[model samples]
Target: MKNRTAVIDLGTNTFNLIIAEKNEGALNELVHLEEGVKLGEGGINKGNIQEAAFLRGMQMMKHFSGLLKKYEVSNYKAIATSAIRNAKNGPDFIKQVKVQTGIVIESINGQKEAEYIYGGVKSSGALSDKTSLILDIGGGSVECILCNHSELFWKESFEIGAARLMDIFHKEDPIPSEKITELNRYLEEKLEPLFEQCKIFKPHNLIGSAGAFDTFVEMIETEKGNDVDLRELKTYLFDSIAFAEITDWLCTSSHEQRINRKSIIPLRVDMIVTASILTGFIIEKLGVKEIGMSAYSMKEGILSKLIR
Candidate 1:
């Protein structure tokens, strides 16, 4: 507890907690946990946290507080992202969370969120000398960073997260072809800014940071019967062909089918389809030829800052 530090990322769809400490001159992670609290489940698009979700968030904070105590973590930071920042009642919710669990929530805007995401991806060593586009798809927003190994060139956070998309375009069980078409069309319009940046940077490698990317890496590994211990690696290389195939499968699968898959977590079962569609859209529209997955993301990025 003396030297250890922890960071919590309160995303729209999930709450992530990571505890880490430096050992023998190297940083090591003690624990990383993600809880599907769905804080913005019923009222995200409406710019509010429903009564039930508000109460639910309080419970999760108390639970997370217990974990922090169990791990003897005294130094910790809790970051609230799109869900809380964009919601009309976000500040009130944050206040209640502090009062309930003694955890102060630092809410951040989209731009700052994108910057943190860049830092997280940079730590993974996924960015190369050449240029890479990093995409982090959360529940309330999607962050796209255009950068490379040495520096981050540009970044923007768009409010088209998987959960947001689910609320907008999820009209059928399997998502009809027309609905897919409509969703893609809508995304094309909203992501124009990112596409413009891509043109200037001409990034060929698309790096996905945490969340759905983690699931993709595991799902692909499981598909190939390769039991690669993800903990040992900072980044996982993705074959474009394999990724495309998986994207197609994911976009067409039903909730029941997705729920049965061990790689697809219960929290992501309903939103993965939209997330996959968004990733696929980016890969195709931006002409990205290579894909890489970073196991580190916002929480990991902030943990570094906390330790500093």
Candidate 2:
């Protein structure tokens, strides 16, 4: 049997698993699964993992562990991000998971997270000779990396992720206008360094990493009545106007309305509004002319390291 490896991404809003194996110098994924555990539901900004949220995370862990055993993974690695890394009880929760499941999860720092996001975006075949600013919108943090196919210029991670934004500003279902303005201003202040780097690099192409971007791709395909399986491509360059329209629709949608969309993932329905605002802020502020989506993200980045 091929040496199958499983990589787990333990995020604030979701837990994703991918099982893959190397074959003749190429990496082939065998299975992929995502669970909406909402590990930060009640306590992201509060700096603690609530009992309910902790239970949800633990349940997902057991589910993933079961799958790992069934697949008989030859190797496995789990990386924990924002929620687990930032929570006051994060270490305790990690210890429990290790004792119960025998799986050790490493909580990565912001700088290292940004590097992994860059690696995944690079493998997605999104960057051209022209530089690209890559954004990975996570539940508890957003990672920004400025790079091209051949060089890396700048990168940073911000704690202003969608879950945190939703916790802070999403009081109204559709999100009030003033809240949107406030969120933009807050982003401007927190992400001034990213703005400065964009000015220096002058990268017009904005490549968004998978997660929220995957939802964007599905929504676009649904709007056009296209049946294309987006998973087939590592990268897709979106039509800027279509993307802008979708962003507006998402921002104006109420919770009930967003939940009804066939294309929007249930886990993302509540945060996509915040996520759209964040994406729109960057596009407008940086004069971004091109928008692209990479099908791969940090999980693939970790897998790349293993196979290499």
- Give model 1's clash tally: 0
Lowest lDDT block of 10, candidate 1? 225-234
TM-score of 1: 0.96
Residue 295 error, candidate 1, Å = 0.8
What is residue 110's positional error in candidate 2, in angstroms? 0.9
Clash count, one per candidate: 0, 0
Question: Cα deviation in Å at residue 162, candidate 1?
Answer: 0.5
As a whole number from 0 to 100, the lDDT of residue 152 in candidate 2 is 86
lDDT of 1 by residue, 263-302 (tens): 8889988899999999999888877788999988887788
Residue pairs that clash (backbone atoms under 3 angstroms), model 1:
none
Candidate 1 Cα misplacement greater than 4 A, ranges: none
- The global Cα lDDT (0 to 1) of model 1 is 0.88
Cα lDDT tens digits, model 2, 1-308, are 45889899999999999999787877787888888999999899999999999998888888888888888888888999999999999999899899888889999999998888888888778888898999999999999999998888998999999999999999898899999999999999999999998889998699999888888989998988976565687899899999999999999999999898989989999898999999999999988889999998898888888777
